[model samples]
Target: MSSDMNKDWPLYEVFIRSKNGLDHKHVGSLHAADATMAIENARDVYTRRMEGNSIWVVESKYITASDPSAQDPFFDPAEDKIYRHPTFYELPEELTHM
Candidate 1:
């Protein structure tokens, strides 16, 4: 292979969604020259068993993750917002769908 092809391009995070699945779960990471190559590589490397119905490949540089150490402050607001929970509200007996 040419040196350009063998060179590490960029890191990519892979996510795979199985058949009839609603959400994609992170599988692994790999290096590729671009988004197109990332998807193709992810499929060949991670889905060789035909386990995935859909694949998502995101460049590692583009992902913005919350700081794990700030979890208390980051998630504290949701704890105080009890109204967001379904059990917080009592649906009338007439509303069976809820």
Candidate 2:
């Protein structure tokens, strides 16, 4: 498609989960008419090698993120909550992953 027509399409963020990965990771972005098209495009473009087992496509505009400039203040509150840290508790010896 022409550049002008591609610009008219909504931007989508693609995330893929590999066979062994527990969480999906952002791979890249693409322009698509809708969510379905985004998934197809993402699969063809990002996972042609068949490395990923799961795919997630989300329109870029719908995502909200914290401002990078405000990172300290935005995440500072969590530092004061010591109980949220994993070091607060001891895991069993059998808990391999933890």
Candidate 3:
């Protein structure tokens, strides 16, 4: 309604999972009073064409993300764990997704 009312609402990040997709992708952001309102707003705004089957909404203030500037050091630990990778394994020809 008013600018001040919108300003008081919390910002929410919207993610949508398509009918054929296994993972949810960030679509956009919106302002809502709470999580329930965020979800309804996201569905109405993003899935008007029935593009997605699932929706996820998260408050912007609660999310924690790594700093892009410190990417190298932050992800370096994962490089040392080679066993975590699937490159060493060979998949059978019948494996469709692999």
Candidate 4:
């Protein structure tokens, strides 16, 4: 592997907002020497047309997520408990949005 592609730099997840009317979305990832460099790289790759106003660079290592393969047993217990739902009670108008 190239020295630039070596283990020195960790992976990063890049998110960018293209315009005022659009929401930021995951564009792509790149190995940057640091956060600032990651942002610059993400801009070059994702906003070539000056397409974005905002950029977010998150180190992939910092992200913690549950395993999708365990979803059935991990989440299915709540599905059978219909009483947990508040549909039977009429909520006051002031609390309607809740």
lDDT (Cα, tens digit) per residue for candidate 3, span 5-92: 8789989999999976489999999999999999999988999998799999999988899899999998988988988988888888
Taking all chains together, the TM-score of candidate 1 against the true structure is 0.68
Q: What is the lDDT of residue 35 in candidate 3?
A: 96
lDDT tens string, model 2, 17-91?
A: 997647999999999999999999998999999869999999999999989999998998898898787796877
lDDT of 1 by residue, 12-47 (tens): 999999876479999999889999999999989999
Model 3 steric clash pairs: none
Per-residue alpha-carbon lDDT of candidate 4 for residues 4-31, written as tens digits (9 for 90 to 100): 7758988899988878778888878889
Error of 4 at 66 (Å): 1.2
Highest-scoring model, TM-score: 2
- CA lDDT of each prediction against the hidden true structure: 0.88, 0.91, 0.91, 0.88
Q: After superposition, which runs of candidate 3 have C-alpha atoms over 4 Å from their true positions? A: 1-6, 76-84
TM-score of model 4 (CA atoms): 0.65
Report model 3's TM-score to 2 decimal places. Answer: 0.71
Candidate 4 backbone clash number: 0
